[model samples]
Target chain A: MRLLSFILGRAAVALLTILVIVTAAFFLTRLAPGGPFDAEVDLDPLVRANLERTYGLDQPIGIQYRRYLGALAAGDLGPSTTYPDRGVSELIADGLPVSLRIGLAALAIATAAGMAAGIFAARNRNRPVDALVMGVASLGVALPAFVVAPFLTLLFGIYLSWLPVAGWGDGSLRHWVLPVVSLALPQVAAIARLTRGAMLETLSADFVRTARAKGLPERRVISAHVLPAAVLPVVSYLGPAIAGVLTGSVIVEQIFALPGLGRFFVQGAINRDYGLVLGIVILYASALILLNLLVDLAYGWLDPRTRTGR
Target chain B: MLLEVSGLRVAYPARGGEVAVVRGVDLAVAPGECLGIVGESGSGKSQTMLAILGLAGPGARVSGSAIFAGEELVGMPQSRLQGLRGDRIGLVFQDSITGLTPHMRIGDQLAEVLVVHRGASPGAARAEALQMLEVLQIPEPAYRLGQYPHELSGGMRQRVMIAMALLCRPALLIADEPTTALDTTVQAAILRSFAKLKAHAGTALVLISHDLGVVAGLADRVAVMYAGRIVESAPAEQLFATPRHPYTKGLLASMPRLDGPPGGPLPAIEGQPPDPAAVADTGCAFAPRCGIARPACMADLPQPAAVGPAHRVACHAVEPA
Candidate 1:
């Protein structure tokens, strides 16, 4: 019962957060120095005014916001200024699946590989293996996706010819290798460091000593007693880390020529496509808020002390 | 003897060299006997037990011979020690709050000892855990089974700890300052539980504590330690009646008494215990703080000399019986 209320409370806060973000994005987009039609150099003023009137841009900001919110309430994201024939929702439908495929795959790989590496390093602490894992994690954090993407392409694509240089070919496993790895690398590095530090601290806790004194095998001690507490920091970190991976896929999508939401987000922002931009921002904000709620719920499950308000 | 430890020394690496914590200690506990080791913090009373159990943290250089049930423990393989630790020898620590895994339910933590050591099925282990909790007289034992460590009070948690340790019916149970972190009332309750445990289990016990009054009630034999060495050891009644070493005498005098004048200043030991790092090689470590110290007390380390039946004192001022 307490868990249900806790979840409800977090979900309510999440909705409020998304609403604030959408409101801020709506005004901030208008506050920027240009409009969607500003790039047309040879367009007549009369045509520009007609275009603005057709898209409701000619109306006062308050009326436009009310109209947008009303359309949003009815599940209409309006027509995209850049893609004249396509609605913002339709564009999102085309891009979201591709983005989700990459994002989910990268998240899985990062969480699993990062935790494994972190545990390995912690187990072999102060040894050569620990130094080596930490050194590579440092490099992963230091290098950006753009730099690492091309470098991987040079080594794995050009030099060895083991994989394709670019493009999503039928969205197969081979197609996912480069984009997913590049997106996941930095998050993996961050998680590894977090898990390693947490694991080290948890290993030295008094309960761990109690577990040892209980005559538990070392493996059982670590797996049952240490891992649960150690993974808490990693779980909390996953909320932001996932958001980062999703947004960071922008450059990877562009470089790999994939039809992901990140590509639409960047193109939408560049062309001042307000409908497309607002739609994508709302989606990202809602997803982030929902993910944070899930993380909180996960915390309640892992640590019972947080189950109630006491 | 259920457990015998001699020449037990535990040292840790420091900047210049190693600093010895438990220096050439000797202790023994017979089957079903309760031996109380009393000393202030850093007196090496706890370290001696930890080193014997191989629970001292990494990089500790433990050199000694500890025989438990005729098996050598000082250099026992970790795998063998793992087998003996909870199955044959149980351990309870001071801080009950941190001594239990915060995330684990009380029943699960208790059940785990039996499951790991005895290969008991989960259902059976849990049933046994509930029984153990009932044995410890935990209020609402069934309700406590589902609760986390943080949900329980400090004394309740300590009781859970004791229950968890005794779940396997180990031959010896070593409780290290089990009641130190509790209130006076709670401490009394825990002591009462320990007394009940002794009467019921017939398990040998090594109770380590800093408070003399704590050990006064339960311990059959009491060993007073100072500056990493045993200064005096005797039957509990005899030691309380006539404490030979000046350090032991000072420790007795410092304890708060109920019959004394209210708010009157308690007699405190004059000087601080010697720092483990700076303890000189050739001298009694407590000589500087000893009121009856002789010149010889500062010249050579005094070995334990028999003063009475099963009583030993390591002071230059005490004559051998």
Candidate 2:
């Protein structure tokens, strides 16, 4: 009964949050300086009436919101304004994989690099080694990816002439290097700082002293006791990070000219593609919810103290 | 002798300069002998115990020698110290709840010490852990091993700590302030269990605490430290019945008595210990705190004076520098 209540509670909140975000997104776009067809050429006078009736774009804002919510309930995301024949679901389905793929890859790399760097910094506290790694973390935090992207491109793409500079390639290892590096730097900084802070605190805990007294090897002491204890606070740090990488992959997709969803979302926004815009908004919300779920799961995994609701 | 600590001095850089916390303290423990080192906080009783286990923190400049079964431990590295701690010299910490890992099951944690020291197979480690818990007088040892630290009461947790320390049948057991934080009833049970375990293993025990009452019933011999130095050492009854040093007399008087009249002033020592800077100097640190201080007490540090068989004191005024 308790677990059932927990799941129900989470699902209810997620449903409410999704409704608020989708509805707010729909109306906020309408509040923008122009209508969905503002940038397009003037429609044929006779067929314009037919277009309005078919897509329900002719209705007032409230009615349109109501219609949108109704269709959403029925699993009907209306056809894209730019491509009237292509359903909204198809557009979303096509674009989502690219963003989710990069998000997951970046998550894995960031977790590994950050955890190692953090452990190193903690093990070598108040030393030259910690100074070097923290210096890199500061650089990662200070410089934006726009600056990092071009520099990385110049070094790997132009100077060494090793990887593709402006575009993602087809079916090859050559394609993944540029965008992956661009996406990884921000996460590395974030995770390393979080892990370092948490690990430092954990190493000072009384259990750590007790572990030493138990005669366990230093590696086992840090790995089993300190790392697991340290990872607890990093879960909260992951919340915003999940939002950043998964939702903010748009810039990277544009820089590398990847055929990912971020590029499609940007183009849709620029072209004022109404159905595609809603599709992207919904996709962003979904990513936020799922990543948060993963974070919550990780919380239960890392700390049994948290699991018992203490 | 199972454990012999001769001329052991635990020094480190104090804020001003180098200072010794446990200064030139010597002690020996035989099989099944319990030696209680009694003193107030910052008296270096705890530091002396840690010095024996080699658990003092970094840059803690130590010298002289700690020989357990004739193996020297003055400048031994941490790896060897780790090996010796559980397998040869089991260390029982003060705080039970904080000592046990909050997240780990009691059984798993118990099994861990045996596995690390004895390399017992998992099943054997688990079985031994359960048996040892039973030995500690923990009710339903097998069932309780699956429980987390918070699930058990304070006495139960301390018992678990004792069980972990005794699992390998170590030659020397160093327990620092074991019952200091516990209530009176729980304290009795923990002490009873310690006595039982000490007998079962024939382990030489070093019990370090500020509480004289806690050590009085357990100790065969008691060493009383004052301001980073052992000011007095004697057999338990001799120390209690006729405390030679004024500081030891003050400590015994300070304990809440069973025989004294009800609701009276507890005898407290007159002053706190010396400054950490002043403590490390080669002068008598406890002279300021000593009630019977003579002019000669502050000029120079006192050497150990032989009072009786196996009794020693470092006091210029009392022991004659």
Candidate 3:
């Protein structure tokens, strides 16, 4: 019953947070230097006025916000100013699947590879293997996705011609290789460091000593006792790490020319496509809040001490 | 003898060289016997047992012979020792809070021993765990089985730890300062449980504590350790009545007595324990602190010499019998 209430409380806070983000995005985008139609050079003043009136941009800020909120409540994101013919929701439908496929895949790979490396390094601490894993993890963290993307393209695409340089072609596994890897690299590095530090600390914990004294095999001692405690810090880290990956995909999507939400987000922002931009912002904010809630729930499941209301 | 340790030494690597913590020590425990080892902190009483059990930390250099049930344990491979520990031998630590895994339920942790050693089914393990808790006189055994370590009180957790250790019915049980972290009432209760365990199971016990009163209650034989060596060893009654070593006598005098004057400062042993790294190679480590330190006490280390039947002491001032 307590856990249920805790989850409900978090969800309510999440909704409030998303609402604040949406309100901020709505006002901030309007406050930027130019109107969405300002780029339409040579257009007659009367035509521009007609265009603003049609999109409800000519209305006062209060009326426009109320109208947008009404439409948002009804699940209508309005027509995209940049695309003219496409609805913001329609554009999202086209792009969100591609973004989710790459994002989820990258997160999965990062979590698996990073935790494995971290556990290995912690177990073989102060040895050559430990040094080697940490050295590579350092390199992974140092090189950003933008830098690693182009470098990987140069190595695998230009020199060896082993994989496709860009684009989400045929929605196939091969198309996922470059972008997913570039996205996962820094995340893997961050998680590896987090896991390694937590694992090392947990390895020396008194309970771990008790586990060892129980005559448990080294394997059981690590997996059953140490891993559950050690993974806690890493689990807490994942919420922000996921947000970073999702937002940071903007650069990756632009470079690779993928039809993902990140590309739409960037293009929408550049053209001041208010509806499209607002829709994507709200989506990302809501997703992040939900993900953080899930992380908290996972933490409680793993550690009973956190279950009781504090 | 169920277990015999001779010249048991444990040293750790230091800047210049290795520093010995448990200098060459010898002791034994027979079937159904209780051997109490008493000392101040850092006297290496705990390290001696840890080394004997092969639970000493990494970088520790442990040497000498520890034979348990006709098998040598000093250099036994870890895989073999794993089988012996928690099966033929049990161990309990001081801090009940940290000694148990906080996340694990009491039943699962208790059942884990049976699962690991006996290869019993989970159902069977759970049943046995419940029985052990009831045997230990824990209230609401069924309810406790579902509770995590944090939910239990300190004494309850210590009881759980003891239950886990004894689940496999080991021939020997070693409890190191088991009641130091508990209140006096709780401490008495835990001591009573240990006495009960010894009587019922016929398990040889090695109880390590700094409190002489605690050991005096349960130990059949007592060994007083000072500066990593057994300074005195005798039958419990004899050792309490006529503690030969000055250090042992000092330790006895320091204990608070119920019949003493109502409001007075309790007697205490003065001076800090000698640093393991700086201990002199020759001379008794306690010689500098001894009230009767002689020139000869500083010149050479005194070996434990027999004074009475089953009694030995290692102080130059004591005349050998």
Residue range B96-148, candidate 2, lDDT tens digits:
45788876788888888888888898789999999888777789888898887
For model 1, how does the per-residue alpha-carbon lDDT over A1-310 read when each residue is reduced to its tens digit?
7767777887788778877887899999988888899885867999999999989999999999999989988989998999989999999999999999999899999999999999999989999999999999999989999999999889998999988888887888898898999999998998888889999999999999999999899998998899999999999998999788877888899888899898899999988999999999999888788777788788878988787654
Q: What ranges in model 3 sit over 4 Å off?
A: none
Better of 1 and 3 by TM-score: 3
Restricted to chain B, the TM-score per model reads: 0.98, 0.94, 0.98
DockQ of predictions, in order shown: 0.85, 0.69, 0.79
Clashing residue pair totals per candidate (backbone < 3 A):
0, 0, 0
- RMSD, each candidate, Å? 1.7, 2.1, 1.3
Q: Estimate the overall C-alpha local distance difference test score of candidate 1.
A: 0.91
Better of 2 and 3 by DockQ: 3
TM-score to true structure, per model: 0.97, 0.95, 0.98
lDDT of each prediction vs. the true structure? 0.91, 0.80, 0.91
Candidate 2 second chain TM: 0.94
The C-alpha stretches of model 2 lying farther than 4 A from their native spots are: A1-4, A40-50, B14-16
Q: Model 2: share of native contacts present?
A: 0.61
How does residue A310 of candidate 3 score in lDDT?
37
Interface RMSD of each: 0.7, 1.3, 0.7
